[model samples]
Target: MESNQEVQISTNAIISFTDSYTQNKQRKEKELLEFESKSARAIISFTDSYAQNKQRKQNEQQESESTLSLAQVTSRLESLSNQIQYNNGCKLVIQIPKLLQSLIALVTFRIGTHLKQEIDLQRIEVRRQSRWCLSSIQVYGDEQIQSELVRQGYGRVMSITLSKAGGIDEEQDEEIYNGLRSISRFLRGLHAGRNNDYQPSFQPLPLLARRSIEQLEEEGANEEIEAQMNNRYNGLIKVWANDAKDMILNCFIYRRRR
Candidate 1:
């Protein structure tokens, strides 16, 4: 009777042990599945985020490329509009050496042809090249190039030369060229001002008549003319220089608002 009872108890213990082992195995399997599911979800989310970032970057790159293309287009248009084309097929497109050569040829031709003398092309070429080299060179390396040039009367000489090089409409070409020379001369003063009158302000060349200033000075220095010296050219020079076609623009932002 005791052996029978012992056997039954042993069976019950074995059954209980088997059931616990099975439950533990099932829990481990469920945990493994949960871990795999979480890993998969993480991978998918990362892929989506990476794809979105890549697309955003591509869009930005495209927009930047478009902006760059527009800038290039605008630059080309401005260059085309400003480029000067001579009847002799020489185009002035901001190239210093080529423009210098054209200027020399034109100047030499004008001088030689007008006097019915032969042109010294070699001499002209050499002088033009040497002048080109000298243009950027510093008398003492100060960026205020105007004082050095002005002291030497370089602006006056250049103005005279531009006036003499006659091919285009003389009045128009001379006006444009002279204005360019003046602006160039003024630019040299920008880095380190030499003319005490020219402060760091952005006021362009004052076009008040030289005679008007002299007269105003002589007549006990009129209060109005004294004030005019500060900003008078702002009102006058553009009207004197702009063409009739371009004059239409002055009706808006250009004309004094006051």
Candidate 2:
């Protein structure tokens, strides 16, 4: 009887150990599966987020590109012109050489010899707006700003433009007049500024203007054109010079009084 009881106790102990081992194995397997599932979910979430971000960037790029239409450019130009009417705006734009070059390029841009009538008209309008902006800069800007513009080939461009002949319509005439006046005004400010106004690298406006006049004459500008150059253009230049001088003198006196 004692032997049987001992055997029964041993059997019970072995069964309990087996049951505990099986439960531990099952728990480990369940934990491994949960870990693998979580890793897969994390990778999938990352991929989706990456795809969404890429799509958003592409949409933004398309939207930005679409806004660069001709109408948008013209509207922006007009807005810029209006802003430049203020002193701060004029100063801000003048500091950026690239922006200045872009503005000048717009003035000189030509699509082709044969553009559609509508396209040509749009081009003309854009050019006109650009010219207006430049003119405003020359008018509102100081001598240093004017000198910078001239240094960037504004004077040279105007010289070439004014010297063009054979198509003098009302609009062309107006353009020429404005171009000439713009040069004259800038030259006036530059002269009044003297050594105090210009950078060391800049050439004098008077020298450039004289050379331009000579070039126009050599290009076969008629006597009528010559007279317009001599009287109307040069005469305005003199008037502007005097105006600039008086302005300087007044500023000087005012500072002295202060």
State which candidate has the highest TM-score.
Answer: 2
Q: How well does model 1 score by local distance difference test?
A: 0.33
TM-scores of all predicted structures = 0.25, 0.50
**What are the per-model numbers of colliding residue pairs?**
0, 0
lDDT agreement with native, every candidate: 0.33, 0.51
Which residue runs of candidate 2 sit more than 4 Å off their true CA positions?
A: 1-67, 164-168, 193-258
Quote the positional error of residue 159 for candidate 2 in Å.
1.9
Per-residue lDDT tens digits of candidate 2, residues 131-212? 7777777667765766566666775555555554112255555655665566555544444343442332233444444443
Error of 1 at 20 (Å): 99
For residue 5, model 2's alpha carbon misses the true position, in angstroms, by 97
Q: Would you give me the overall lDDT of model 2?
A: 0.51
